[model samples]
Target: MRYFLIPALTAFLAAQTIRVGVDLVSVPVLVLSREGRVVPDLQPADFHLFDNDVPQAFVLDTSVSPLSVAIVVQANQDVRAYLPFIAKIGNAVDALLIGEAGEAAAVVYGDEVTVAKPFESGDLSLALRKLAPDGRNARAIDAGMRAIDLLRARASNHRRVLLYIGQPADHGSESPLDELRDAAETYNVTIHAVALPEIGKTFVSDTFSLQGLSSRSDRGGFKAGTDLGRLIPTVARTAAAAQSADPFSVLAAATGGTQLHFREQKQLEDAVAILGIELHSDYVLSFTPKGTGYHTLRVEVDVPGAKTHARPGYRLTTN
Candidate 1:
C-alpha cells in the first residue's frame, strides 16, 4: 500500500505543469585568439561551452532585437592622451544604434557616472561634448563600477554591451572579488576592456635616475652594481598586476566579453567597430532549464566546416 501511494503521488506531480517565472535569455560571445590576432571564419561547432565546469547545449538564431549599450569612458590623464580614440568609439556606437529605432546608448564619464542619450531624438554629439574628462583628482574605478551598476539596472530583456575605455583601478572599492563576481553573475553583464597605451615609462625613468647614485655608492662605487634590469622587471610586474586586477577583465571574462589593448587611436576605433559588428551579426537563443534552481547554459553554432567564436557558458536563474 505504501509503494502504490508513493507512485501515485509522483505521477500526479509529474502530470501537473508548473509555470516558471520570467525566463530571460542572452547569449554573449567573446572573440579571442591565443596569439591576440582575430580568428575568422569560425563556426559554432569549433567552440565548446561550459557552466560551473558542466556542459549544456548550444543554439544560434540570427534576428534583430533591441539592445542596450553602455559606453564607460575612463578619462584619467592616461586616457586623456587617447581622446581621439574615445571619440571614434562614440561615433561607431552612435552609428550602430541610430539605425535601429528602439536601440539605446548611454555615455558616462568618470566625473559624471550616469547620463542618458536620447536614442530616439537626442544627438549623440552633444552628449559626447557633455562628457567632461576626469578631474585631476577623480577616481576611475569607482566611477566605472557606478556606471556598470546603472547600466545593468536599465537593461531589461535586451542584450547589453558594456565598453570600458581606460585603465581599471580598484583603489577605493570595498567589495571583495567574490562579491564583485556575484554581482556580475546576477546581472549577466558582459565587460569588454580597452587598455590604453602604457604611460609608466616617464615615471620609471625618473625613479631609475633617482636611485642610480644610491645603488652605485653602496656597491663599492661600481656602476654595474645598480642593475636596472632587476628593478625594471619588478616594476613592470607590479604595474601589470595592479592594472590587470582592475575589474575590467574580471567582469569581461565572467560575462564572455573580449578585452582589447590599443597602441593607437585607429586601433581603438577599429576595435569598437568590430565589437558593434559582432553584436549585430551574432544570433540569439532561448531555452528553459531542464531542472529548477540555477542552471548553466552553453551556446555553439553548427557551421560544419568553419571555426566559431562563442561564449563558454552562462548562468540561468531558474524557477
Candidate 2:
C-alpha cells in the first residue's frame, strides 16, 4: 500500500505518497480511461514511476486503503454565518471521507489553533458543534501545521491526508505558507481544501477547479507528464510557478490535492461526496528512493488513452 506526495500540484497525493524508507513518499494516482471511468485493475509493470524525472522501482496498490485524515477548519468571525453548516458536517465526513476503518482528528483556527477532537476520541460531530468563532484573524497556515503534526504521529499503514476548510487567502498567520507546505512535503502529506468566502461570497469558485481533474473523455486530453508536473514546489520557496494568490490553492496543487470553492451548504456537501469518490478510486504507487534533497515525481500508465493525475514530488532527508 502507498501513503502519497508530489511537486507542484494543488493536492490528493501521486494522484499523491509512499513508505518503506526513512521518510515515506506516497503518491495517490487517478487513472481514467478515454471513456472517463476509473481504471481499476493494473499491475505495477503497467505503470512507470519516476523521481526527479528518473524512473525508479515501485509497488502499486489498488485497493481499499484506510486513511489517517486531519480535518482543519477555519473558525473565525469571517465565516460565522457558515459555522452551523460546518459544524454539522461531521456526519458527512464520517460517512464519506474517513468511514469506519479510518481515523480522523479535527483542528479549528480563529485566533489560535484548537484541537476539537483527538485521533483516539472520535465524536467529531459534538466537538465540531461546540465550536464558536473566536478571533478576528484567520490563522489558516498555523492550523494546517497543527494538523500535519497530528497526522505525523499516526501509524504509517494509513494514508496521510489533510482536509482544509477555510477562506481562500490567509489573514494573520505568523508562519509563512511555505513553512506549512514544506512540512507537508517532507512528511508526504496529501492536502485537499474547500475555500469558504465571507458570507455573501459563497458558491463562486476560485480561478482553478477540480471539475476536470479525474474525468476527461478526450483520450488526447491528458497523458503522462501532463498532470502533477511538480507535486511539491521547491521547499526553498524558489519556484514562483507554484505561487498562488489563494494560499490554499498553492498547498492543494503542490501536494497532489485539489482546491475547491463553496459558499453554500449544498456546495460544501457536494464537495465532500465528490472527494470521497475520488479518494476511494485512486491507484496508489509507492517507492523507496536513495539520496536526499527535493525529488520530482512523474507517473506513466500503460493503458491506452488513460489520463493520470498524480503527486509531482516530495522532500527527503537522511538521518
Global lDDT of each candidate: 0.46, 0.70
lDDT of 2 by residue, 72-165 (tens): 9988888888898888788777766776678889999998888999998959888888889988988989899899999988887788889998
Model 1 TM-score (2 dp): 0.62
Q: Model 1, range 1-319, lDDT digits (tens) per residue?
A: 0122223222322222111113544555423222222223344465555545455454533344455566666654545766655654444555543233234555555444455463344666566555556654334445445545765665365565566776655433444554554555556556566656444631111011111112222221111113323211110123343235557656655555656656665555545544544454344444344443344445443433222344434544532
**Given candidate 1, what's the lDDT at residue 55?**
59
Residue 19 error, candidate 2, Å: 9.5
| Model 1 lDDT at residue 240 | 44
For each candidate, what TM-score against the reference?
A: 0.62, 0.80
Model 2 segments beyond 4 Å from truth?
Answer: 1-24, 198-203, 206-241
Model 2, TM vs. native: 0.80
Q: Relative to the unseen true structure, what is the C-alpha lDDT of residue 100 in candidate 2, on a scale of 0 to 100?
A: 60
